[model samples]
Target: MGPARVAGRRVGQFPDGSESASIYMNSGTCYDLMKNPTKAIEVYNEGISKYPTVSLLYFNKAITLFNSGNVEEAMTTTESAIRYNPYHASSHNILALSTANSNKVYSLLAGLYFLAAEPLGKRASGRLKVVEELIGSNVKKDGEKKVNISMPAGDKIANKPNDFSSVELMMSMSAALSYSDSYKDETNIEQMKRNLGSIFGVLSETTAAKGGKKAGDKKAGFGWEFYAPFFADLQKKDFLDTYCHIIYASSEDDANTQWIKDNSCLKKLTTLLK
Candidate 1:
């Protein structure tokens, strides 16, 4: 979906000003899902202003900031989200992802290993592996087994320095590191490397074992992280044309704005955001 359609769909006319919060919040979600983080941020700010106590507004804003690579602002916004709703799962998840990318090892580990363990990290590991396989790696040898590697103790690895010349190698290594069972250890750089290599080895084995092809190995498919490109592809293939027609017919309106307002998806999303 394009930004204009998304914006129009979610910003339906509400009779009461009190409903403006709902409208803005829903608009923010549509913008975020469409990969327009700046628009999402703006709508979320408007939502928060209309309903100061709505924790989901802040949480969604934080997510948009994080996805936009505004780590500092995202962190601050996450703190506010937690302050408003301490038990919000999506807030914690976004905070965790942001912390992981920012090199906040302790907090990131806590988020991934403890708070968001069951729902986030394990699923993320699977997704990471899928991406690795798509990038032409075999993943069968890894087989979900935890690998142990011995290494010297230090803040940095002095023993087997990385050769960062190859972008493909670096990307593969980064993806592999996400599946390492002990990524939480700040002092185990060598162990991290070894575990990553193990993952790589597993990918190689899986590829060879399968005689060179695996299911869904064509391209990077749809996921939350790459929603924009996916949405663009859908538009290119005229999928949105059918969707818009259905939405319009159901609501008796040419615009999807009214249909989205009557739908309950955004309500569920609000709970998730909180």
Candidate 2:
């Protein structure tokens, strides 16, 4: 899909409308459009140097790397992006695509995140379709235990010396709350939901433990951090309604089968259940 594969995956724009940030992202995007992977990587690296905490910069850089055939490096950079922000749906989506053949469980977990975080995203439908195809595949290696999120997304990523993003440390505590053991016997979307619910449980526990303060001092309410992507730009009740619906949704429930499409990429992923 060329470098353009990475173009539509961007989610959040530069913060505060900083001209420098826009220049960084715009230059990267421009380079990508021009099919100059070298220049795109340079621009994104520059952005990372200037704004070390900006996860989107890392995400864009990883995409360029992937398009340039630097698959290993791209995986590393994508993991960096996720370290900076667990809510980055695009980062998770990229990871899912990059490592699908290696780890079916991890790939599906990433897909679950991408769908949950960017249910209404423009490019998510296509990506979701790809992930759904993982259903019924016997890709698990022998001795594979629970979801092995311990390693980076790949060998190359594991080799890199990564500094834990503050976000990573904060979210790690919550990630520990994931239901790693509950879905060992499930497959496809059922397994996906178990992971999804596990992540929610983690976020719920972490947010409560933190007394409701997010990384930027934003006050969260109850399980808001777990549902941060949805709550980021919503009324409390609307966010709550969305969260409750997803947590309770079922494939057989007609209202949910229809409603999920409007609210998430679940509609796009429904084909997996077939």
Return the TM-score for each candidate structure.
0.40, 0.48
Q: How high is the lDDT of residue 147 in model 1?
A: 31
- Model 2, position 11, has a per-residue lDDT of 19
Record all residue pairs in model 1 with backbone atoms less than 3 Å apart, i.e. clashing. 138-203, 138-207, 139-203
Q: Distance from true position, residue 213, model 1, in Å? A: 56
On residues 6-99, what C-alpha lDDT tens digit does candidate 1 reach at each position?
Answer: 5555564553553656667677888788778887888788778778888888888887887788986886677577657656656656665665
Q: What is the lDDT of candidate 1?
A: 0.45
Runs of candidate 2 exceeding 4 Å displacement: 1-19, 120-128, 139-253, 257-274
Question: Which 10 residues in a row give candidate 1 its minimum summed lDDT?
Answer: 157-166
The residue ranges of model 1 lying beyond 4 angstroms of the native Cα positions read 1-16, 101-106, 109-121, 124-274
Q: What is the lDDT of residue 99 in candidate 1?
A: 50
